[model samples]
Target: MSFTVAIVGRPNVGKSTLFNRLVGKKLALVDDTPGVTRDRRPGDAKLIDLKFTIIDTAGLEEAGPETLEGRMRAQTEAAVDDADLTLFVVDAKFGLTPLDKTFGELLRRSGKPVVLVANKSEARGSDAGFYDAYTLGLGEPVPISAEHGQGMIDLRDAIVEALGEERAFPEADDEAETNIDVRDSDFAGDADEEAEPEYDETKPLRVAIIGRPNAGKSTLINRFLGEDRLLTGPEAGITRDSISVEWEWRDRTIKMFDTAGMRKKARVQEKLEKLSVADALRSIRFAETVVIVFDATIPFEKQDLQLVDLVLREGRAAVLAFNKWDLVEDTQAVLADLREKTERLLPQARGLRAVPISGQTGYGLDKLMQSIIDTDKVWNKRISTARLNRWLDGVQTQHPPPAVSGRRLKLKYMTQVKARPPAFMVSCTRPDALPESYIRYLINGLRADFDIPGVPIRMHFKAGENPFEGRKKKR
Candidate 1:
């Protein structure tokens, strides 16, 4: 197993910045604001020659067990439990505070190796703070500027010495790239064969859980994991970045992304909030299946409907999840009202699957997962050209295209061009003259006839070539 290091510190001390730097990507959301990271996010980090797993966790804080800060501290403690070493970070520029000493004592009690890091050491007069950090009794502070890439070599050596291995830092000249030999021989036999298409169960299914702030998005994820893998509390907008965790449910690998709850565009004013929202949107676009979480107590808010519409527009397979069902009373009345609203407000996502779940109590989770599997099957549905043309024939016979300027517009042929949000192309006379309503009619017919529900469909019309233009029709 790869060695794991958990970065633990008080709020806003550049822990996430160091994480982003080590991972060589802005994987974690960083802001001047404190307590931005709520979940424990893991990344493959490389420092000089040391490659290992690094976890960026919420900053440690002292609070009552029921408060939001207390929940964040619990998440940090869990990450510490899973780590081979803990990097206790502190701001050298500002000097150590009482909270740092308290956190240091807690880390010491955990019985894990700790490395004290003095961040922002590039600032002048920071040596006093670095010296003071030694009193915490962790070790000599490794002073470095996480923002400017200063003192990394010293930090790398400290980590190597702490791990007690020279393998952590290899010689620069010893590493070489391997080249492959690809000379085909007659003894190799026939090489021209088309491999049969098959599903690879080894690959994890990427699913993004999204909803408005405080809608129990993170809670639902923690429920699925059966552990406090993510921070959850009564606080709104606690989650800032999209954190992915690999999990297995009933023998299937799933990569679940717990994204920051998205607020409406009008309300998202701060730069940090905008970045968080953008990151969430990126998760939705990349995800194979997106579960839109809804608070059953306040179902179908304006932003919720907007997010649903956005998911449909992106052509991603979706399942609507109503969370907090355990607290919901009069389930029949609520479900009936939800159905009416779904039909009225979300006609664009016709036949979408909806599941009622309680993230707190683990109710109806199996059905939620099954809905995702079924929706994915429909999303990847492929239609044979023969079948498409046959369906097109029946559709055109039932409702012929309207005449344009006294000339009948003829739809000649149809064929599926692609799947995964199935797309089709049709060759027709006066394709441009075919009205938008006609296209909608064709799309609707395709959806109903092919049993495509809760997935977007694309249709294209190609004007037919004139028959007499290329031939001498008059003998």
Candidate 2:
């Protein structure tokens, strides 16, 4: 149920720059050279409240008409095929070129939604070229300077209208989705029921490694798999699609996936890039706990951060894996900085555990595996109501739900609703007023006290008194 926008234009049109601006990362290797981006990089593209997947494509080129460049262009064309909207970028400073015209014609012929973007239009002399964008027939071109961050508001409105998303950034503001299990010992009565299923400790928890291209995602996976199953090098981007492998660790069947590297949007110009990143996301959905890998050299680039955000948003428990730990100097300083940045940069999924390891040298692999095991435990944890209600009572007593419309909403009780990305349910007078910050506090508390680390936790607030008040509600 995700929407998509494909960024297509000739090379060196700042398509990757615009992609980095929207996805908030320098994921695409930017150079003065044309066609620097060969692979298609897709990220969870967001413009304020407009949430959609964005594909940063390689620049179209005039190759031997059937060579690699030609085939690459063909891939770019295919990206346009799947997009709900296309961002047609042009270099306003450089003016329109013949290649631009050719692709422009192809885009128009596709008959899909298109938004013409005249990037690098901040220079005084760029106006004439920006004006020429009108001739492309993609509609009134929005002049934007991706590097300097100009015309964003106008671009925001345009995207909102084009994608049909909200005008404001989404509410990171929903009530918790946790429901406590307060059923009596025999509440879940079943004619065919036997003893409760024994919690299997021997099962190797399924885990995944996901991140933008060149963020050391494959490196991390290699360390866990204990071999170089996937190729790794200094190349800016190497992964092409999701690769899954199975291994046993301490009698646990740990399945790991090394996924295609995702670049920020504009860099993803080819059809192959789109297919690659999509495959990685699909892997995350199947993983119980996904390890979002980050390059130790440049941790938390906008695209890498967004990938982590996407995993949690997709309802998967996530752990932060800082790869290439061996190359980093002053390890403690880096960890401290990472902790600070994660807390500030990713406030939505708070209390996420971060472990540093060198995927190449195998440093800290043991700790990483332990952390994964611990996080998986949290992901599958089901909190007992007696303990939960007690915690909720104390939390409410300390900091009651804030008043809404001069009517104080009372949160009567809470219980663990489910497990596997553990969910909690809070019965309250007005569930609407439960602040996001408060719910986060409860999750942090649960993680710390109950040893639930690294995975995502959900807490839900239901209106009215406890669902099981007085006579127990049916389990």
Candidate 3:
């Protein structure tokens, strides 16, 4: 098993910055604003030859149970509990604050292996703060600049030493331990007609649940886990960051993400809300399958439709679900209306899977889980070159391209470039001149012919180049 490290510290200590630096990607949003990271974001970090899973958590803060800061602290604590080691970061430029001492004491009580990190050490006079960090009693602070990428080697060594020999050499054991338990759902539903999914014990399927404010996204996740793992209340926008949990459904390993409830652009005035929306979008992009949850009573709002469109544009498979089903009096009417709206409003994602569920009562939770597994199957669907080309022939013959500038556009060849949205590349003359309508026609044809549904289809048109002419330079 890879070593798990959680970066924890007081607000604005550059923990997110350091996380972005270590992951070698802008996975987490970094800003001068304190308490920006509300959820625990996990990423695979690489330091030269060292590889391990790293979690970027919200800043440790003191607040009452009802306050937002208090909830953020709860999420961070959960990350610390799950981690094998913790990187206790402190702001070297600002020196140690009262809050830093509190966090240090908290980490001490936890008794987890910790590597003290003093961030912003590249600044002038920052050495004083680095020295002050020693008082925390964790160890000699590894001073480094998370923004400027300085002193990483020292930080790497510190982490390696903290991990020790057992974790560093994982290959020593013939079988790696998997924490996920394989169990079947209580409901007895037949698996989809598609080939039995090849379950990979190593990688968990990444699933994201997204919706507008107060849509019960967190509630749904909590219900699926059979516990109140995620904090939920009657308040809208309680969840401000994308928090993920390792889950198992029907013996399948799944990494489920409960994202911040997205409000319309006009309503998002505060800087924090905008950050939350961005975090939710990132969760959708990273997820293998996204479940667009909706409150059944008021489903299909403008924002909900927009979220569905965004997911399709991102080339991710989606499952539409209506939460609070127990509250709906006329269930049949609501379901029918939703089906009509789904077809009329979101034609791009035709044949989208929909499930009615009650997050509060746990009704239809099994169906929702089944849809997620099925949607993921379709999302990763791949068609062979031979089958793709054969279908392309029939599609072109059925609806030939219209003449452009008094010349017919010659379609030469077609092949799938990749899957996970199943991208295709078509080689033909005057590819740029092809109309959007024609592209959609080909996309829909490919979708229907391949029995691919509920997932986005990507088609790229390329102008066919003459092989002989390219071989010899034109004189």
How do the predictions measure up, each by TM-score? 0.88, 0.55, 0.74
Model 1 CA lDDT for position 126: 95
RMSD of each: 5.8, 16.1, 7.2
Query: Which regions of candidate 1 deviate over 4 angstroms?
Result: 166-203, 465-475
Candidate 3 residue spans exceeding 4 A from truth: 48-50, 157-204, 226-235, 238-245, 266-279, 376-453, 456-475
Query: Which tens-of-lDDT digit does each residue in 266-311 have in candidate 2?
Result: 8888765676676677777777778888888888888988888898
The residue ranges of model 2 lying beyond 4 angstroms of the native Cα positions read 1-199, 465-475
Among residues 3 or more apart in sequence or in different chains, the pairs in candidate 1 whose N, CA or C atoms overlap within 3 Å are none
Q: Estimate the overall C-alpha local distance difference test score of candidate 2.
A: 0.75
Could you tell me the TM-score of candidate 2? 0.55
Best by TM-score: 1
Clash tally, candidates in order: 0, 31, 0
**CA lDDT for candidate 3:** 0.84
For candidate 2, give the lDDT of residue 72.
Answer: 60
lDDT of 1 by residue, 1-475 (tens): 2478999999999999999988899989989999888788999898987877899999888898798888888888889988888899999999999999999998878787788899999999998998999999888889999999998888888887777684454444432423233322212222222331343445457799999999998888888998878877777998888999888987988888999999889999998999899899989887888999999999899999999999888878889999999988899999998988887888786788999999999999999998988887777666767777788888889998999999999888887665556677899997889999988898888778888888878788998777678776676
Candidate 3 lDDT over residue span 256-292, tens digit each: 9898898888989988788888888888877888999
